[model samples]
Target chain A: MSATIHRLDNRPQPSLEPMVQLVAQDMNLVNAVILDRMQSEIPLIPELAGHLIAGGGKRMRPMLTLASAKLLGYPGNRHHRLAAAVEFIHTATLLHDDVVDGSDLRRGKRTANLIWGNPASVLVGDFLFSRSFELMVEDGSLKVLKILSSASAIIAEGEVNQLTAARRLDIGEQRYLDIIGAKTAALFAAACRIAAVVAERPEAEEAALDAYGRNLGIAFQLVDDAIDYVSDADTMGKDAGDDFREGKMTLPVILAFARGSEEDRRFWQAAIHGHRTSDADFAQAVSLIRGARAVEDTLARARHYGQRAIDALGLFAGGKAKDAMIEAVEFAIGRAY
Target chain B: MSATIHRLDNRPQPSLEPMVQLVAQDMNLVNAVILDRMQSEIPLIPELAGHLIAGGGKRMRPMLTLASAKLLGYPGNRHHRLAAAVEFIHTATLLHDDVVDGSDLRRGKRTANLIWGNPASVLVGDFLFSRSFELMVEDGSLKVLKILSSASAIIAEGEVNQLTAARRLDIGEQRYLDIIGAKTAALFAAACRIAAVVAERPEAEEAALDAYGRNLGIAFQLVDDAIDYVSDADTMGKDAGDDFREGKMTLPVILAFARGSEEDRRFWQAAIHGHRTSDADFAQAVSLIRGARAVEDTLARARHYGQRAIDALGLFAGGKAKDAMIEAVEFAIGRAY
Candidate 1:
């Protein structure tokens, strides 16, 4: 276990480059499938989808698929198509999410919903989702299909759960975990699990990768939430306090509210319920969060999940694949700083 | 062929009752699957989904699946779950459609989007869609998966296609057929075709059922478009000119534009482009449509498809199932009058 442990502090900086480099050749195939399958006779389908697909996303989920496959020594191209399907599912969710959140900017650019309006965004998202299923069906693996379709349902359920929990100060850490678990981690888990499946590995191996992806996903989301309070638009790509502006409940806010004094709690209540919104309000909110050490604790939580994620890959043999996978977790956690 | 022919005029009124009765017992099982699968830990999922699912939809697509199964003399319970899956897909599309169209009323009730907001509608629609695939995956039929998944993609493509075509006075009849054939008829075809696959029927029979459902769906849409001009909300269960107000292009408008005099063409161009939208404008539009005989010609087109739908069933043996299926087509077209 000690031998498999790859410490992040041993290096000056942790990066996603290792995973991206490990899967570089495979990533090309996945990208091709994404570009090819996203095409439709309708000009807008390709034009709008291309805006995001061609947009500078890290392809994190699909990269996980390729790297996991490489780690297992899986010698097949099935994961390439499957990886594209994962990205499509992710893209579809992003499209709907932008509409749901009414987000104007994503990854430092205007959202598809912002450019095309919500109606086109919704329809095209539906298209990509259906296309993802079609890709799965073409792969013709019931096991893979079941995993993805179930993950998709869980993600949607989680989204609806989060939607219902919005602006409510009473939502606790456990409920928040449940929401992110379903919404963010489910796909991450499925993305890695399918690699095991396509590799025809044992159930134990599949479970290990699933654990790896899931914990990493939770860490990934936690760090994103934390970064919103700590960083601004240029560095983060997503604007800081965008979640606060949308009144999204995250770990930082929940912890701050729970740990705040009477006046601080009143400020949070106003902020969550929509009374507090401007840059000054966000600045104050950040100060309150810092005072409560909410962001620090949030980063601590991300470290917990990131460690679990790293530990999950321990059972696999030590190699470049494992190092990249472990470092990917680090990069996810490292993003907030 | 002569013995199988059942004309609409043979009865005082054609109704959806016979087909509904033919599939009544089977629909009960399908309904159970729908209710059971739509549930989640999140309360809003069920509450919001139930608002639309239990709303007064006629269950047309699933009923076609059941009746087509009966027509094939397939003795199996598999179609019930699959039928529910089909319904789930339809419901998901309706939820998204409401958001896309900003529709206020459906089946004489306020839309779920109107009640719950667009975000909830979008998320719940995605949930239902994923649940539909999960049900199909549980059934473990790759062929059915291919058909439904493909159809879902086509439906979404059609929707996007229609979005681009909206309010454009230049869109003609062929493109409209292509659009409806996708958005409406593809699901209808897949719904009927999957029953044959579950029944283990040959390709010819599957194609026959597909043809039957496709034509019926086209006829259904034509009649629906025509009724929007000829009937009121009390009878039609949807507000007349709602499409017109929204600047939707249907066969009626295309034909009206194609056949109208220059003066009339200018009115339609203005109406479609948003210069005309009021009770008075709709009344004037209705008069112009009547003067151009667009509604009459639209119903004529519906009957043409209805005849094709009936003829597609001619390959099957004449019996209660066939009669009900044929009558369903008649009921579809007869709604216009």
Candidate 2:
């Protein structure tokens, strides 16, 4: 059977508002640091960076860092900077991804590449990436630096692997999973693990939090990929079918392509390889994906990962932080619902 | 008054061979480490990275790191990785720069962007950048991370500033210096300073080496800028008058525009702003720049910086590293002669 759907009249299921509320104070500090670090004498650096940084998102990754630090009863302000660094890394990747994907919109607004052009976007993204490292250095923890830096390397590898695999319909589910793991989950894992490192928590605690974030990240991306087929620009904060147009090999596409008939396979190949996608083509692709139960399968996979994310937190004592973390996973999977 | 101009019959002056010889063994280890760290499961990463890594520019930046470490009498292998990290940062910037500049050629060959396309180049550049940080993390020194990371950020700022200043004829000498200082010298300064830190030397020694590298870097870039106007693609390893065609505000152009006749100023404005340039126009521009003695004046400024670089070495004890470093400075200026 398909996983339990948690839609409340097809609206965004119980939002990430609670988790965000729990970390609001720490997030304010993180936001302040982000703004301060983004400042530059070059107006374009700040102007282009501010365009993306100020755009609205859940700030989920940084929140995970702050909440994880709080869960372990940390007694310092170091996590604030680490959280900010996490946010900067995320923002930097988003900026560069827009350029890589040739995207025109992000967070329901014009992409930075669209506004400032690719050169500025690329350079500003570099600035943000470097600034993130500076934040990690200011915290003066080599362990934190190791985790974050390795994650950054893995993220780039994942992005490259994805680029290499794009439009290649032969890629299996495992490779797709690997792509998302490196591209999305690695950062999340590092962000949470760093929280434990800064708090001087034991190895087991660090591993647990890392596992939580990693699974959560995978689930988040699975749902995200699923939503790309089902949601619109308003709900997803970007044009729906962007992945299809870009020929990204997400879960639903992989599943649909695998399960398709000969004629259906030809359609995917024509649209993906030949770049012959149009409005009618996207509609037909979506119908084929739904007929293959690909969206349902993708959500099932997301729920499986989301359950693991919650289970990873079982060792932690139950509290607002723990409870909110679990709820955040639910919120993530609920997006697919 | 114009300082020594050791042209050696219009050839590149005394090469950086001595410095490379001094750090030969250490560079071997650095090369090994760079090759090791550049490896990834994704074959494209190593392929593209290896293409540039093996493309045979003198490993001058990494050599500086190794030489600095040796000069300070350090007795450790940590600098091997740090040097590799330095080179990765430099290479990553070059890869990204090629994309940003839409360059077709580098070091007498087609650029990676030309071969792999912009998307792969951008992502691979990111992979290399992240790999550099991973190397720094492996070095396990927060101070080294701080210095290198800050340099990276400043370099991005410098690059963005240069992009902004491109084609702006009114930009003065100080801003031009600021651009090169950030873009070039900052990394050189950091690469040298890290040696002192790793050696646990006093702050004075660190500051001295930093000053030395910074000045050398500025001089090297100034000479490079001047060479772009006077040298051919064969000598410079890239196209001549590239900066002029791209409207980059190098010192020779800045000096020429500042000192030009009214009609000459308008010519520069039309060529730079209006993009009204041709082969004949380039010949005319060269004559105008030479008539203004801007290339000579630019060489004069490079000599000034080279002198400061040599002066910064006075406090250090006499050794092969020091001698090679001085010779390297002479070689940098010699390029312009």
DockQ of structure 2:
0.84
Where does candidate 1 stray beyond 4 Å?
A1-3, B1-4
What does each candidate score in C-alpha RMSD?
1.2, 3.5
Query: What lDDT score is found at residue B251 in candidate 2?
Result: 91
Off by over 4 Å in 2: A1-12, B1-13
List, residue by residue over A100-137, the lDDT tens digit for candidate 2.
99999888999988988899889999999999999999
TM-score of each: 0.99, 0.96
Question: How much TM-score does chain B earn in each model?
Answer: 0.98, 0.95
Q: How would you encode candidate 1's per-residue C-alpha lDDT over B21-45 as one tens digit per residue?
A: 9989999999999999999999999
Candidate 2 interface CA RMSD, Å: 0.6
lDDT of 1 by residue, A146-166 (tens): 999999999999999999999
Total clashing pairs for each candidate: 0, 0
- Where does model 2 sit among the CAPRI classes? high
Worst 10 residues of 1 chain A by lDDT: A1-10
lDDT tens digits by residue: candidate 2, B55-118: 9898878888888887888999889999999999999999999999989888988999999988
